[model samples]
Target: MDTQLLLLLLLAMVLMASVAQRFPENSCAQYFQYVQSGIGSFQGELTLGLQNGRNRIDVRFSQLGAHDQSVVGALLPYPDEVTVRASLRAAKFRVSLWADASAVLPKLTRLVYNNNELCRASEYNPQSFFNRFFELHINGPQSPHRVAPTPVIHKFPEGQTDVQIKTVVFDGSERSISHILSDFVNEQTATSAADWAPKSPAITSISSSAVPRQRWPTSSVPTISSIAPAPWKPATPASPFIPNGIRASPPSSVPWPSFVCGQEGTGVPYIQRGMEFPRGRYPWLTAVYHKESFSLAFKCGGSLVSTSLVITAAHCVYKIREDRVLVALGRYDLDNYSEDGAEMRDARRIVMHPEYSSRLQLQPDADIALITLDSPVIFNDIISPICLWETAETETEAEIGSIAGWGTDENGNSMTRYPRVVDAKIATVGECARRWKVQKILDRTLCAGNLDGSGPCLGDSGGGLMIKRNNRWLLRGVVSLGERSTVDHCNNNQYVLYCDLAKHMTWIRQYIS
Candidate 1:
């Protein structure tokens, strides 16, 4: 009740508030106590420290009333992390020390937070069930990065045993504690099914390791059982139907388009029962024609990427005479040459990816090509270039990439009148590799299709594999190859390969603005 005592209490409260407001100039730490209740009770503790962008983590886990244990302690670089990979057996685990953590933290933070209570439980709120013991906020403004809703991590099973993960932190204000906790939740609760899925190296360390799995040593430093795999590099693919012959071209030159690319186009609304894309639906779709004696035949598909540039599969033009090729932009119906929005351009030059080869069967290696139009094509509502995909991250899991072209349809018949457009589910890198038995599929090729006979067919070569984002269509891949049917047409039962455009950005930018 004395004045001195009241003043001392007020000062103490203010000091506590300041500590919660911000960390010291370059040092901070946090601790967490993880407890899981039920059948097999579990308890653990984690400590995290950050100083000068570097991270130090120490974790100890024990099954309640039992001696079974697991511990991970490591000092990681700014963008590195410690990952724990366990198989069916709880003890059969691979603890990778200092794997690349860059992919795991920043990306998850940028995702749009959906109203998922379980995932929200992974947040770093002090009052939450996960229990955040302490946190030190950075004094500066919060990060402004935002992204679309990312996949949410599911919660642990209820009842007998609850897995509680406790983590401590130090100087991790730049990288918030919430992001770190979310990453841990994802790693800890991953299902066996996800083990086969293609995930970023930071999340799943499924690579050839020099070290073998073994018992952990009774020491402060966690033993490293594996070295992180090098980053996944994009590979490429090529068309299969084009005949081999020398393609010729004159000294090529053309002006670039002045307007923006990848603008939305107006056409008939999507009809679930129909596969035929209406006129003006895809302004960038170009029918590549092979000039025959006094006539032209639709040979392949192409995409208008710029006023002067068209992208297609390398095998479509490789070794084929460029002079005999004609590119018709804004064309929809293959049978009618004088459709309202059709315009044909001469091929001034043809350039295949330097690494592309026609001899490589079932391999889509460097399968992209660029064609130089003789002159700049004027843009209209029905004739515009599509934007190239520029996202650094790979396509999201189960995302759909659309294919539209004059490929053959069901019943083994050619689409002689109009191009067909279909949405195909993009397959993961591991799925692609396993289906085709080609490890090189990881780098430059993307695999996508439906086993329900719904995908690109014969003559769909060189067509664009497009994905829409922000109301604009982005070119993600070029149709390359797939299995052949017993009748020598496309095998719709398998996934098809396309040349991943992201891998060839450096080469593409040299030719584009």
Candidate 2:
């Protein structure tokens, strides 16, 4: 042979060796062709190499219809073997191609190449061959292409799909393909792949092999549709009788002054002595009277301090005939009057503290009254005894004290008799004096009630102004006058003055006996 011929032969042998080396020791590359002789027909499957590498295969398809045909495709990667399948069905003809797994080259170990040149064939093209062979879709059919509908993405692990592929290499190296299809599905579903073909509609068959089924209702039942009922509304609260602005005052700013006597020509001395009751020991105490007939009556609460001495407010004794006064002691409920209930006593003489004035009745001295009962009250739970005054040189106003009367709560709303007695801290003399503009808080009287409007009102007068000393309840003062003005001139101030017991301990003792 000539030298040139020998060189050409050597070159060809080298090329063959290189190609053989590229494939798995025994794998071979294959080509496939599919012809869709009609419109709206397609089928295909792909296999991936276990190892990471490129794969090449040849594919062909035919378009025999007047309108453009669609083809669905899928790629599945595997570890041991790779399979490629494609089918095309037309009205007149059908074509199918399947690449055996064992015979095909491992997808991970092959090199792929494409033919850039374009050609038109009868009912088929070379581009399909390349795409199907390599398990990839090549760019073609730009116009008149059908786009696949987007897929809906769901929260994963719940709606995840798994795809796996396997291939067997001649060298016995196994490879696998596994991935969560959800992410890819989600991305493809979200993005519009311009080159993708629309999915084929699912195929169904009605053949003789089908069994007969029982007839059932196909029409949906008409629903008597109803809506949820509207939400319930809340009832309104009761409006208070006192003015909203008046009730808004702080409980500590009320202008309550000390009740004073003897300076005003009232035969009553500045101080009087009486039996002193210790705290928590007033179990002998009783209610001398409680108002029941008058719903709006101001004499709702008072006590019998002595047998003849019926202690009450001058105002409560105001505007009423002395005959109307009926004292009920030892009673829990005013509406229920029985001998076994609160002891009932009649009033013969009602002598309000002479100095007790009502000019504004704003002064504390004018707030007190001494009503002399026709007969002495017998002590019982319904008519228990309350300890009276103890004469002292002077009683400090800051002494921790309590006022027990049938007064209203912070809102001036009356409470039931069972829990009528309300107690609050006494304001300092300086604070009370400053707020009320009283020059001298008499030695006979001490001041109580919050500077606010929280002191005695209409009914609380003449009630015992008891003090708690060493856990004993003492009558320190009388619940005399709260803010006297009906208009609440001292707005926002809740002060109340009491007839100081220390000044009257002597008189109270003599008169009660």
Candidate 3:
């Protein structure tokens, strides 16, 4: 009898050990840290602690009016085995597995309440608790949700009161960081596809038949071996991107060295109802082309940033034959053969951001690219490079910037002899969300244009939105895609979205440096 009792006790201990292994004691803490780190600087009145060996997060939703069943029911009916309990101001969610919890995040939005999605990420307002929780659980800290998140908390269009999550807790395993990031990517792709239509006016290249035929034999193109590259020098105060780095001082204190880049030519500016760019007003402007049957045809616009590097939209270069890519610098009048200062060079290499995708369900995160020319561009007064934007604060201070391209004219016609530049005001995230009807805008992209139809149009994709500071033109944004309200022309009534250059400093520096 004694031997049997000892054996039974041993068996009981083994069973308890197995259960403990499956549900570790520190699982909740691990999950909390991962979420907290992801939340980054958006930490509001969110607190994390352990309750009965389960991780609990305490969040207060002062904006919800009242923490009642209405709020709880919208978050229901729970994802399978997850358990949740709510009080007046606090809630506790015991998640057996974080993976199962992924499906619950979207239901937190107003869409679950049967309201039309007035804007994407309606729940991601920092003023509300759900926004922090969602960001914490979805996007990682370094990868911000939006560059400048909207501060306005929109009310439901309908009479129904919106429920905002104040405080909540998640208890789960330590192996959640990787899973969470994976979910973020997947969700971003799906949400992007749903928000922005693939048929949007991404490519502005006019068909070859529209333009006069120009013969360019393959043998006449410059090869990498035949061209000698000049020694390119880096500009002053070499350092990584500073968020508001140059905001404290005036532009004079941090003057960009014009010897290398950011120098405008002595071309007279002409402004009418539509702005017309003179021969050398915007010198950095470049025209990217693709080889057709026996002649080169205009494809996209680009900004020459260095001796051999040109920046443009990724969609312009993606999946195209490398040898067929050509760039023409110092070109002003496309139809005028008498125009001087134009030099065409074959593209040596094209580098598109790895994250760039046109998949049905993918985020338009990295719609930028860098092209290396076969030969170093001989910079002239009419063909110098432009400076990459150094500070994010400059954008806000300027408010409005200039965009130039030989896109559709005011009448939505084909390419004209000369390009035009117009002033476009920066738009807010909330405004863009409503205008574009998107759920989320990547931090690496921004929206700007005029409601009167004075923004980028067909043939403008890959062009630069430039801002003048201290008498120098700086590249701020790239023309990505414009609202296609009409069939063949850009919807001048809506705003055009541009890839934010400020957000990709690290990636840009890697190649330029």
**Regions more than 4 Å wrong, model 3:** 1-260, 267-273, 359-364, 392-398
On residues 25-135, what C-alpha lDDT tens digit does candidate 2 reach at each position?
212122212222223222232222212121222223322111111121222222112121111110011122222222222121111222211122222212122122222
Error of 2 at 242 (Å): 40
What are the per-residue Cα lDDT tens digits for candidate 3 across 180-203?
111111000011111110010101
TM-score computed on alpha carbons, candidate 2: 0.39
lDDT of every model, 2 decimals: 0.49, 0.34, 0.49
By TM-score, the better pick of 2 and 3 is 3
TM-score of each: 0.49, 0.39, 0.49
**Candidate 2, after superposition: displacement of residue 179 in Å?**
98
Off by over 4 Å in 2: 1-300, 338-340, 411-417, 437-444, 450-455, 484-493, 506-512
User: Mind giving the per-residue lDDT tens digits that candidate 1 earns over 105-152?
Assistant: 100101111211111212211211111111121223332321223355
Residue 367, model 1: lDDT of 90
Residue 157 alpha-carbon offset, candidate 2, angstroms: 73
> Model 3: C-alpha RMSD to truth?
27.0
